[model samples]
Target: MSSMKKRMIKGMVRWSVLPADCILNSCIINIYKEGDYIPPHIDHHDFVRPFCIFMSKGNIIFGKEIYFVGLSEFRGSVTIPLPVGSVLILKGNGADLAKHYIPRVPWHKVLVTLRRMDHSKIPYGFQSDLELEELRLYEL
Candidate 1:
């Protein structure tokens, strides 16, 4: 994970909104299996600082119906495909604004991988077998 942190610090990522006096705080590597998907959710917590996601495998399919305030809605959901070596950096605030989810209808399955940096450290990987409870929320 430290190696990944170093890579991110050296990588060039444009932020949608930049904060004052920001630093490379932390990183988490999320690997999702096939048919695994995240439901509609937001990372609007106060402690979650500006973060970025480097896609390792598969693609993140955003829901068309679900939306967050002050964020752009995808036209019938967008497929963010990433090859093995490619990377996708979401500007901290804008990335936070996007409401991410996997729709039950049509039964689409996608892996929305992320490497988030915050003021504090968060546990890496899925915390539970239940899809809805996979992402554990903690105060950072």
Candidate 2:
């Protein structure tokens, strides 16, 4: 594994948000600019719950039914601010039942998401990284 990825994993482990046995093998980096937004939707079942590390200030909306308020605005039952350096672990009803999305960002924002791939969803010919096979969080 790349040293950078190893460091990121270690940092996430230190947060103790995910289970000690959870093995995260994939990541998604999101970069949003002013007026950029993600529409509300539930996560696909292709992967386990995701852990998101926020790198900038923003708000994420979550609700059973998200309503559109304007071209770059939305309203949900709950709005959570994602402060810089905050880690959010999604699971249970928060992950399965509630739909979530980011409204248009006011400025530049970034997020790093980590997740474990479901065995059935592993792409053909993709090999698991041996180094990550036994990865576990350290006791915090």
Candidate 3:
């Protein structure tokens, strides 16, 4: 697909080594300011197995393998403080089992995410189910 190829090229331009024909669903850009955070949760399975997540602006404290139990939660063994312009690719059960989240930041930050899709995994004739696609119609 042209869109998938375009997304792959975009990632390559950002210095990614992924194949140029990698089937990517789309690119998501998030801009978070002070006091903003990404709530702890596992990435959805709509996309493919590997998720390419990166940051382009400021630094962030990245938590991995988070375990939650009702009103309480526990941090796993890995706690990485990511630097600017860092790219992380997660595959297999990395996302399926472990949860990752970015805590509230004291400064502004920007994140670019590339999500791939397995055409076979996607439900057929469900394009209308995509809110983003509907929004794209108005160029919103």
lDDT of each: 0.44, 0.76, 0.60
* Model 3, global lDDT: 0.60
Q: Supply candidate 1's per-residue lDDT for 60.
A: 55
Collision pairs in model 2: none
Winning model by TM-score: 2
Q: Which segments of candidate 1 are over 4 A away from where they belong?
A: 13-21, 47-50, 67-76, 102-140
lDDT of 1 at 136: 28
TM-scores for all candidates: the values are 0.48, 0.86, 0.63
Candidate 3 lDDT over residue span 82-129, tens digit each: 767677776766667767776666788888787766666766664522
Relative to the unseen true structure, what is the C-alpha lDDT of residue 49 in candidate 1, on a scale of 0 to 100? Answer: 48
Error of 2 at 56 (Å): 1.7
lDDT of 2: 0.76
Give the backbone clash total of model 1.
Answer: 0
In candidate 2 the C-alpha lDDT for residue 128 amounts to: 70
Residue lDDT tens for model 2, 41-90? 88887878754445577788899998989886778999998777776788
Q: What would the TM-score be for candidate 2 when compared with the true structure? A: 0.86
